[model samples]
Target: MSIWSESTQSRAKEILAKYPEKRSAVMPLLYLAMAEDGWLTIEGMTEVAEWVGITPAQVQSVASFYTMYKREPTGKYLVSLCTSISCMLLGSDDVLHAIEDESGVPHGETDDEGVISVEHAECIGACGGAVACQVNYELIEGLTPEKGRELVRWLKKARPDAVNTDEMQELFGGRRSFDWAIQSDVGAAGPYPAFEPYGTATEDAK
Candidate 1:
C-alpha cells in the first residue's frame, strides 16, 4: 500500500506535472511526505524515491541537507529562536534562555508533553525584526524574554488546532520586517511546509 492518501496522491501528481523532470519534483514531494507524517519517515522517503525514480539514499540525502525537514519526531510547535548576528546583538540569547526555562527543555529538545520544541536557528531571514523566532515556521518578531516565556506557556496550555501568524505577531511580536498589506490565515503545524491551505492533513483530520 502507498503511504500517501488519495488526496495527497492526486496532489503529488499535480506537482509532478508542473515540473519538466520528475526529479525536480523531489522537494515538493518530500514536503508532502513530511506533512503526512509530521516528519520524514523511512517509509515516506521510500515512497518519494519510487515516485521520482530515485534511490532512497538519494532522497535521504536531500532531506538531510535541509533543516526544514525533520528527521526525527518533533513537537507540534517547533520554536526556532534566531541566534544570528542581528538577533543575538538584540538579546536573542536571553530570550532563548527564557524559553528554555519556561518550557523546561534545552535547545534541540522537546517538552515533556511534546507540545513544544526549542532550538537555536542561525537566521530566519527576519533580521529587521531582531530577536525573532519561528513557531512551526511562522515568523514571530521582536520577542522579549517575557514574551518568549508567554508564547511557550500559551502553546502548552492552549494547544490550539491552528496557530495564526498574524494573531501571534499582534499579541507577542513587535517591530515588523516590512509593512504587511495582505492578511493570511495559514497556520503552520510542524517544521516542514504544510501542504494544505488551512494546515497539513494531519491537522485537518483533527
Candidate 2:
C-alpha cells in the first residue's frame, strides 16, 4: 500500500544518511520517485516528503519548479527534440513534426501505450549537433526528419541487450534499478547536508 517498495525505502535511508539532514536528500529522493514510477506521482511525492521530513507541499513546490521532473506518467522512453535558435535553423521543427506524426504523439504528451513521449526542449547544449534529439536525455545527434522517425521506431523495437550504443546502454542501464542508497558514502561526517549553490555563469568569467 506504500508508494515505495521495501527495497526502495531501504535505499531512501541510505540516501538520507549521505546528507547531514534528511531534507538535503529531497532532490535525489524525488529523482528516485520519478525513476521508480517513471514520473512524480502525488503518492510518490508524499512518500518522498515523509522520508525527507518535509511537507508534501514543499516537495511539490520543488518538483514543479524543475522542468526535468515529470508530474505525470511518461513512456518508457522520453524523446526530446531541441528547437532552439540553432536547432530551429537546422530543421529541428521538421524533425519534431516527423516524430510527432510517426509516433502519433503530440509535443509535451505521451502516447496511451506509454512507450514513447515527445517534447520540444529549449537548448540541450548541443547546438553544434543541430537538430539534436535525445532518447531519455542521451544525445542522438545529426538528426533529419526521416532519421527521427526511424530512430523512434528503432527505440520501440530495440532490445536492451541487443544494443551496443553508449546512449542505449545508459538509457536502459538502470531503467528499473532504483538503488540510490548504494551510491552513498555513509562514513562521511554527520550533518553533511547537501546544498544547492546559486551563482551566475558570468561570475567565473573573470
Candidate 3:
C-alpha cells in the first residue's frame, strides 16, 4: 500500500531502533515517505510497520489519527485554510466557500486537474491570524474572502500549468501577503498539543 522509495524504506528501518514506543515513530516516518512520494499509500505505512517491528494495524491507526499524514494525492498547491471556531467567528466559512468556488474541489478530495486541493484543519495555532492557512507548506495568515479569492487567482497565474485561468495572469501577485502565525490562546487551549512534529526515518533504524 505504501509508495515509499527504497531510500525511505531503508531510513525507516534505521530510525525505528531508537524508539521505545514504535508508535512514536509512525508520524515522522509517514511524513518522510509522503514527502518522497507526494502521498502516503497503505503499502507505504505497512512497510514502515515492518521496519519498526510493529503490526500494520498500529501504523494504520497512527496514520489515520493524524491529519498531517496525507493518505491521498495532494495538489501542486495545498491551501489549508483554518475553519475552526476562531476562524469561523471571523468569517472563515465564507473564505472556504470562495476557495471551493474557485477550485471546484471539496474537503478531503483532490481536484480533477489536481491544481489546488483543500484540507480543513482545526486552528493551525494561529488564532491571531484568525482565518489563516498553510499553502505549499508555507504559512499564510490574515485571511479575508476577497484576499482568499486573490490568492486562488495569484496561484493560478503563477503556475498556469497548475490551473486553467487566463484571468489569473491578470491578477496582482505582489503586495500584502498575509502573515502565517499570529499570537493566540486558541491553539493553546486545544485538547491536543500542536507542537507534535512527525517522525522521520533515519539511517540508524535501518
Best by TM-score: 1
lDDT of each: 0.84, 0.67, 0.61
List model 2 lDDT by residue over 1-206, tens digit each. Answer: 45777766777777788889778899888877765676778988998888887899999999899887888888767788899999899888999999999999999999898878899998987677677776655555667887788777876776221222234323322222122233311110100111122100111110
Candidate 1 lDDT over 14-127, as tens digits, reads 889988999998888888887788778999999999999999999999989988888888888889999999999999999999999999989999777778888999999999
Which window of 10 residues has the lowest lDDT sum in candidate 3? 185-194
Ranking by lDDT: 1, 2, 3
* lDDT value, candidate 2, whole model: 0.67
- Model 3 scores a TM of 0.69
TM-score per candidate, in order?
A: 0.92, 0.75, 0.69
Worst 10 residues of 1 by lDDT: 197-206
Between candidates 1 and 3, the one scoring higher on lDDT is: 1
When 1 and 2 are scored with TM-score, the better candidate is 1
